[model samples]
Target chain A: MSGQQSTTSTSIGSRLLDWSLRGYVVLVFVFIFAPILFSVVFSFNSARFPTIPLESFTLHWYQTIWNDPDVWTAVRNSLIVSVCTALIATLLGFCTAYTDYRYNFRFKSAYLALVLLPPTIPLIIMALAMLAWFSKIGASGQLWSIIIAHSVLTAPFAMAIIRLRLNQMDRDLESAAWNLGASEWRTMREVIVPFCKPAIVSALFLTAAVSFDEFAISWFVSGLNKTVPVLILEIVQGNIDPQVNAIGTFVFLVSMTLVIVAQIFFTFRAGKSFS
Target chain B: MARTNFSGFATTWRMPIIVWQVLFFLGPLLFMIAMSFFLVKNYRMVEAFELKNWEKMLTRGYFWDSYILTFWLASLTTAVTSLLAFPASFALAFKVSPSVRRWALFFLIIPFFTSYLVRIFSWYVILAESGVVNALLAHIGLGPYTMLNTKFGTLVGYMTLTLPLVVVLQTFALANIDRNLVQAAHNLGCSPARAIYAVIVPLAKTGLIVAALFCFILSFGDFVSPYYLGGSKPPTLPILIIDTTKSGQQWPRAAVVAVVMMLTLISIAFAALALAYRKRASR
Candidate 1:
C-alpha cells in the first residue's frame, strides 16, 4: 500500500519506535534497580553520607551493625518470625487449597474470596485491626503476635501458589490411589503431597520472603520485638546513617536469596507441568 | 475412603483453616469496628458503646483533608504508573523473545520481595537538597532544587513501589492476547499505535483496569511514602491513623479511621470488579 520512498520512511520511523521501546525497558530496569544498587554500593562507602564521589570501599558500616546488639536482636526476632510464619502459613495454605480442590459446597466462592482477600486491603488498616485485637487479648508486644499477624498476611499467597499446582495436577492420580485401596490419608501423603512438592517448597520460600520483607504491619504489632525493617526504620526515622545501608544490604541479600530460590522451584514445576 | 467419612474428611481438612481465618482475620476486623465505638476512659479503652471516637475523628477538618489527599495521590499514582508501565509492557509482550520475557518477569518481580522502605529510602539520597541529583546538576548549573519531603518525592516513592508490579501485571495481560488480531489490524493498514489503542486495549481492558486498581489500593493505604518522603505535609489518612494512636493512645480513634478506610476499599474493590467485567455493547 506504499511507494518505495514512503515505505523506507515508515520503516525508519518504525525502527526508531522499536529502539525507543527497548531503551525504555532498559531505563525502567535501571530505575527499578537504581535505589537498590545505590544502597548496596553505598553500604561500604568509607564516606558517612551517601553522596557522590564515594570514598574508598570499606566494611566499616557492616562491622558497626555486626557489633550493634540491637541489630542482633532484630535479626534474631526476624528470623524466628519469618521461619515460624512460613511453616504455619504453608500448612494453612495447603489445607485451604486442598479444600478448594476436593470440595464443591455452597459458599465456596465466598470461602475462596476470603482466602484471597488479605492482599487487596491496605496494610495500614490491617495493622490497625491486628494491633487492636492483639492488645485486647493481652498478646500485644510479643514475638508470637508478629508471627500470627504475618501468617494471616501471607497464607493467602501460599494458598494461591499451591492452588495453581493443584489445578495442574492430574486428577486421575488421586483417584487411582484411592482405587488401589489407599486410605484418604495415605493418598494425601503419597500422591497429592509428592505432586505438589515443588509448589509447597516454593510457597514456603515465597511466604518467608514476604514476611521477612514486610514492614508496616510488623512495625505496629512487633512492639519491642522489632524485625530488621523496624530497626532500620528507627535508625532512618529523622536522620541518615550509613548503618541503614549496611543493614539494608544484608536484608536485601537475604530476601533476594529466598525469592530466587522460590522462583527456581516455581519454574521447575512450570517446566514439569507444561511438558 | 468411606462414603460417610465425607463429613469427617471435610471437617478435618477445612475446619481448622476456616476457624483460623475467622478468629484471626475476620475477628480482628470485627473487633476494630467495635473498638471504634468503645469509650477511651482515663486513657484506657473501657467497655462502653459510644460515638465519641467517631465524632472526634470525623468532626476534625484535618481528617477529611487527609482523606481527600490520600485519594487524590492514589488516583494520580495509578494514572502515572499505568501510563509509565505501558510502553515497556507493550515491548515485552509483543517485541521480546520468550527467554527475554521470562528474564524480564523475574527481574520485575525481584523488587516486590525487597524492602519497600528501602526502596523509598534509596530515593531520599538522590532527591534531597544536598543529594546526588544536586551534585550532578552543579556541573550544568541546574537543580539544587527542593525535591525531598515534597509531593514530588511522595509521587516518586509511589511510582517506585507500584511500577514494577504494574509492569508485571500489564505485560502478563498483554502477552496473553491473541497476536493474530494485531496482524490482521496491520494487514488492514493500521499503524502500530492505532492498532494498540483500538484493538489491543479493548481486548485487555479488564486486566489493565484491575492492575490500575491494585496500584490505587496500595498507594491509598501506604503510610511510609507519605510520612517519610512527603514529610507528612498535612498527613494522609494512614499517617493520621498512626499519629492518632501515637498522640494520646487514641487506639479507638485510629480504629475509626481504619474502619472508614476498610469501607472505602471494599466499595472501591467491588465497583472496580464490576467495571472490569462489564460487557461492551455490540456494534
Candidate 2:
C-alpha cells in the first residue's frame, strides 16, 4: 500500500515538472518572437501606426519602398559594400586559416587571437577607431572605408567557420597526394580546395549577411552615402514612417534566408543531414 | 625545388592576412589611442599632446553619470537575462529530444539574424501609447501607462536583444555538464531544484559567466536602444561619444570616451577570466 502511494505521488510530481518545463520553453519562444511577428504583421497594415483595429491589409508600404529611388540607391550601396566585404573577408580568412592549419609558424596562436579580436571589441569602439583612422587617412565616409571596417568585423567569423571544416578534413589525403609525387600546387588545387569549398561558400554567405546588417560602423564611415540600416535609422528617427516597416520586413526576410542558407551549407559540410 | 617552393608558399600564405590586420585592425586602434591624447584646436585634431581632453572629460559629472547608468543598465539586463535563460536552457538541454533541440536552437538564432533595428522598432511601436500593450491594458480597464521613452523601455529592448545569445550559450553549457552528477545528487535524496542549484549551476559557471559578460558588453555599448527608447534622459556612453564626435566636433573628447569605454570592458573581461581561472585552480 505504501509503495503504491509513493509511486502515484512520484508520477504526479514528474508530470507537473514536465508541464512546467514545456510552459517555460513556450513562454521564452513567445518572448523572443512576439515583436518580430508583430512587425511582420503590421508591415501589411494600411494603417499608418502599427496599432491594430483589425485594419485592411495592403502591400502599399512595400510598394512605396520599392519605388523610392533613394532606397534603391541605398540598397545598391549596401549590396556593393556587402559583396566587397564578403570577398575581402573570405579571402583573408581563408588564407589565415589555411596557413595556420598547414604550418606551425611562430606566434601562430597570437596571430589567430588578433584575428578574433574585432568581434569581441565593442562595435562603438571599433566604429570610433575606424572613423578616426579613416579621416586621418583622407578616406572618411568612403565605401572602401566601410568595406574595410566590415571586413575586419566579419573575417574572424569566416576564419573560425572555415577552420572547423579544415580540422575535420582527412590529413592523410594531403600526405597521400604528396607521397604519390604530386606537386604542392597540384595537390592544393585538386585536394584542399575541393575539400574546403563548402566552408568557403558558407563563409561568403555569413559574411555577406553580417556586412549587410552592419549599421554602427557604416553609419560612422558612409559619409554621404547611407547603407540600408543607416537609411532605416533615419526613417525611424524622422517621421516614424510605416513604409520603413516594409523595408524592414524585406531586409529581415533576406537576412534570415542568408543565415539559413549558411547554416544549411555548414551542416552539409559537417556531414550532418537534417533528417 | 618542390620542397623549397612548398615552404615558400607556406611562409608567404600568412602575408595577406598579416598586412590586412596591421593596416586595418591594429592600425585603427592605435590611431584612436593616439588621437585621444591630442588636443582639438579649431575643431581639428592638433598634433600636440595634452591632458586637457582626458582631464575635462573626467571632471564632467555627465561623463561619470553616463558610465554609471550604462553599468547599471547592463548589469540589470544581464541579471534578468541570465535568470530567464537558465530555465529555458535547462529545458532545451535536457527535456527536449536531440532533433527537436536542433530545430529549437535554429529558431532561437534565426530571430537574431534579422535586423536588430527592426526588432527595436517593433518594440517601440508595441510600447507606444496607443500601441498593443496599452490597447491590451485598456481592454482590461487598466493603465494606458507609458512604456516608450523610458528606462523600462530601454531595459526591455536590451533584454530582448541579449536574451537569445544568453540562452544559446547557457544551453550549450548545460548540455556539456555531466548528467551523472545531477543524478547522483538526486539519488542522495536531494530535490531536483536543490540539485540544480547545488550541482548544475556550479558546473555551468564558466558558460554563465561568459554569457553574462557578452550580454553586458553588447548592451553597455549599444547606441540604438538607448537613443530610441531612452526618451530625454542623458544617453548611454556610445550615444554620448557619437554626439560629441559628430555634432560637437570634439574628436579628442570622443576618442577619450571611446578609450575609457574600451578600458572598462577589457577590465571586466579580465576580471571574469581571472575569477574563472582562480576557481579552476582551486578546484
Candidate 3:
C-alpha cells in the first residue's frame, strides 16, 4: 500500500513538471514572436502611429510603398548587390573549403583562421576600414564596392557551412571516381558538386540574405546608391511612417520564404545523405 | 606534364581566395590600424604617429562606463537567453516528436531571416509608450511607463534577437545526448528533473559554454539594439565608436576603442575555452 502511494505521488510530481515545461515553452515562443507578429499586423493597421486603441485594418501602407519609386530602386539595388555577392562568396568559399579539406598542407590552421577572422571583427571597425581603403583606391561610393565588401563579410559563413558538409562526405566515393578513369575535374563535377548541393544551396540563401540586409558597410560604402536597409534608416531617422512597416513586412516574408525553401531542401537532402 | 599540371590545379584552387582575403580583408584591417596611429591635426590626418587618441580613450571615464555597461548587459542577456532557451530545447529534444521538432526549429529560425534592422525597429514600435506592452499594462490599470528608449528596452531587444541562436545551439546539443544514459538514470530511481540536471547538463557543458560565448560576443559588439532601444544617456561602445568616427572623423580614437573591444573579446574567448577544458579534465 505504501509503495502504491509513493508511486502515485511521484507520478503526480512528474506530471506537474511536464505541464510547467510545456507552459514555459509556449510562453517563450510567445515572447520571442511578439514583435514579429506585431510588425506584420501593424503593417496593415490604419493608424499612422502604429499604436493602440486597436485601429481598423487597411492596406494603405502597402499601397503607399508600392507607388514609391525610391523603395523600388533601393530594392533593385539590394537585389543586384546580393546576387553578385552570393555568387562570388559561395564559389570562393567552396573552392577554399575544398582545398583545405582535400590537401594536407603546412599552416592550414592559420589559413583557416584568417578566413574566419573577418566575421569576428566588429562590423563598425571593418566598415570604417573598408570605407577608408576603398576611398584610397578610388572604389568608394560604388555598387561594386558594396558587393565586394559584403562578399568579404559573408564568405566566411559560406566557407564554414561548406567545410562542415565536406568533412562529413565519404572520401572513398571521390577516390573510386578517380580510380574508374574519371578525370579530377570530372570526379568533382559529377560526384563532389552533386553531393555538396545542399550546402551550396544553403550557402546561397544565407549569403544572399546577409548581403540583401547588410547595413553598416553598405551605409558607409554605397554613397549614392542606397540599399533598402539604408533607405529604411533614412526614413527611420526622418519620420514615423507606417509604410516602413509595410516594406519591412514584405522583406521579412520574402527572406523567410527563401530560408524555409532552402531549409526544406537541405533537410531532405541531409536525410537522404545520412541514410 | 599532365600529372604535374593536374597536381598544380588541385593545389592552386586556393589562390583566388588567398588573394581576395589578402587584398580586401587583411589589407584594410592593417590600414585601419595604421591610420589610427597617425595624428589628427586641424581636422585632417597627419602623417606623423601619435598615441594621443589611445591615451584619450583609456583615460576617459565615458569610455570605461560604456565598456562596463556593455559587459553587464551582455552577461545579463547571456543569462536570460540561456534560462529561456534551455528548457524549451529540453522539451523539444525529449518531449516532442521528430517531425514536430523539425517544424518547431523552422519556426524558430524563420524570424532571424528578416532584416535585422526591421527586427530591431519592430521592438521600438511594440514597446513604445502607447504600444502593445504599455497598452496591455494600461488595460490592467498599470503603467504607460516609457520602455522604448531605455536599458530595459535594450535588454528585451537583445533577448529576442539572440533567442533563435541560443535555442538552436542548445537543441542541437540536447539532441546529441545518449538516450541510454538518461534511461539508466531513470532505472536507478532518479527523477526526470534530477536526471536532466545531473546527467544531461554535465555532458552538454561544452556546447552550452560555446553557445554562451557566442551570445556574449554578438551582444557585446551589437550597435543596432543599443542604438535603437538604448537611450542616449550612456552610449554603448559601438555607438561611441561610430559617432566618433563619423562626426569627428577621429579614426585613431575609434580604432583605439575597436582594438580594446577586440582584445576583450579574444581574452574572454580564451578564458571560456580554458574553463571548458578544465571542466573536461576534472571529469
Candidate 4:
C-alpha cells in the first residue's frame, strides 16, 4: 500500500485474471469457428456420413456436384437473383439515402422508419407476406419473385451503407458543382454519383451476399425456380446428404468473398486511390 | 441560387425509392394483414372480410403452444447469450489492446456475413447421435448423449445465430464505458469482481439489455434452425406457418400467425426502447 506498484499479491492476481480473460476469448472464438471448420472438413472427407476417424481425403462430392445439372441450375439462378437484387437494391438505397441526406421534409422520420423496417421483421413473416402477394398477383414461383423479395429485404441495408457515406460528404461539394454552372442532373451525375461510387459498389456486394445466402424468402416465393440455398434445403430435408456439404462449402466461399470485398471497399475513402 | 431548383430534383431522387419501398415492403405487410382475414375455399384462398382465420388460430391449443414455446425459447436464448457473452465482451472492452479489439470485432462480424443456415447445418452433423460429438464422448468413457432433434439442438442453432452478433454488440457497449469509474471503485477497496458488478455493469446496463433483446428478436423469428436442427419435432411458430401454408394451402391461416408474430415484435421493440430510454427517477 506504500507505493502504487508495491503490492506483490495484487500484481500476481491481476496477471492471473488477465491471462484467464485472454483464454476465455480464445475459447469463445473456438466456439464460433468450430462448426464452420467441421463443415469445411467434412465436405472434403470421402465418407458419406460426417463421422469421426475421417475417411481418405477425396473430392468426389465436389466432382459429383460439378456434374449435376440441377446444381448448376441453382447456381445460375442464385447468380441471376443476387446480381439483379444487388443492382436494384443499391439504386434504391442510393436514392433514398441521397434524399435523406439532401432534403428536409415532413414525415421524414416516418419515411426513414418504413425504409429501415425490413431487417427488423421476422423473416418468416416477411416470407409469408411475400408469398401471399406474389401468388395473388400471379408472380409466384418465378426467379424474379425471389429477386423482388430479396431487394425489399436488402435495400434497407444498402440505404444504410450509402447514407453513412453520404453523411461524410462535404456539405458544399454538390452546391459548389451547381454554382459552377453544372445542371442539377449533371452535378448529380458528375459529383454526387462519383462521390458515392465506392459506397454504391459496397452496398451492391453486401446486398448480393445477403440475397445469395437468403433461404426462407426464396423458399416461400421461388415456386419452382430454386436458388442454391433452397436446393441445399431440399437435399437435406429429413435425411443427411454429403451433397449438401459440398454445395454449402461452395456457397460459403462465394458469400465470404463478396462480403470481404465489400468490407474492403467500404473502408476505402472515396478519392483515396486517386489521391 | 442553384438551390432554387434543388428541391424539385430532390423529389425526383426520392420518389422512385419511396415507390419501391411502399410497393414491395409496406404493400406486402398490409396485404398480409388482409390475407389473414380472407377465407380458404377448396384449398384456395378467397379474398374476403372475415375473422375465422384469426379466431381459429387464436383459439387453437397447438397454435398457442407454439406461441408460448417460441416465446420461452427466445427468452432462454436471450438469457443464455447475455450471460455467456458478458465475460468475453468484458475482456475485449478492458483487457485487450485497441488493435486486438478491432480484430476481434472483424472476426465477430465475419460470421454475420456468412450463411447462417450453413452454421446451423454444421451443428446438425456434430449433434447427430452417431456424429462427431458422440464419437468423441466415446473416447472419454462418457456415454453418448442424444442432442439432435430436441430442444437442445434448437438451442444450439439459436446460439449459433445470436452469439457472435451479441458478443459484437456487447463488446461495443462495454468498451464505451468509462474506465476511470472502475479504477476508482478498485481504489476504494472494492475487489475486482465487485467493481465489475457495481460500477461497470451499471454503466453498461442499457447496451447489455438492448443486445440481449436483439438476440431474442433473431432467435424468435429464425425458421431454418428450428426446422433442420430441432427436427421440427414440435414446430416453432415459423415452422407452424410453413406447415399451415404447405399442407392445406391455408395461406390465410398462415397469415394469422404472421400477423401475431409481427405484433409481438413491434410490441417488444417499443417496450425495450422505452426501458432503454427511460429517465432515471430523481435520486
Winning model by DockQ: 1
lDDT of 3 by residue, B1-283 (tens): 7789688777667777888899999888887777767788898877657788888888999999999998899999999888879999898888778987888888887766677778778888888888878988988999989987788888887877788888888888888889999999988999777998999988777788888888888788888888888874688888888888879888778877877887899999999888766645453
Runs in model 3 with CA error above 4 Å?
A: A1-6, A273-275, B279-283
- Ranking of all predicted structures according to DockQ, beginning with the best and ending with the worst: 1, 2, 4, 3
**Per-residue lDDT of A53 in model 1:** 69
Looking at candidate 1 chain A, the ten consecutive residues that score lowest on lDDT are A266-275
B169-199 per-residue lDDT for model 2 (tens digits): 9999999999888889988999888988888
Q: Give the CA lDDT, 0 to 100, for residue A216 in model 3.
A: 86
Model 2 per-residue lDDT tens digits across residues A183-256: 88888889887888888888999899999898889999899899999999889889777887788888888888
What would the TM-scores of all predictions be?
0.97, 0.96, 0.94, 0.96
Docking class of 2: medium
Candidate 2 colliding pairs: A141-A221
Residue B241 shift from truth in candidate 1, angstroms = 0.6
Clashes of each: 0, 1, 0, 1
lDDT of 1 at B111: 92
List DockQ, one per candidate, in order. Answer: 0.77, 0.73, 0.63, 0.72
Clashing pairs in 3: none
Residue A10 displacement (Å), model 1: 1.4
> For candidate 3 chain A, which ten residues in a row score worst on lDDT?
A266-275
Of the pair 1 and 2, which is ahead by lDDT? 1
Can you rank all candidates by lDDT, best first? Answer: 1, 4, 2, 3
- Stretches > 4 Å off in candidate 1: A1-6, A273-275
Which wins on lDDT, candidate 1 or candidate 4? 1
How accurate locally is residue B35 in candidate 2, as Cα lDDT from 0 to 100? 88
Q: What stretches of model 2 exceed 4 Å from their correct place?
A: A1-5, A272-275, B280-283
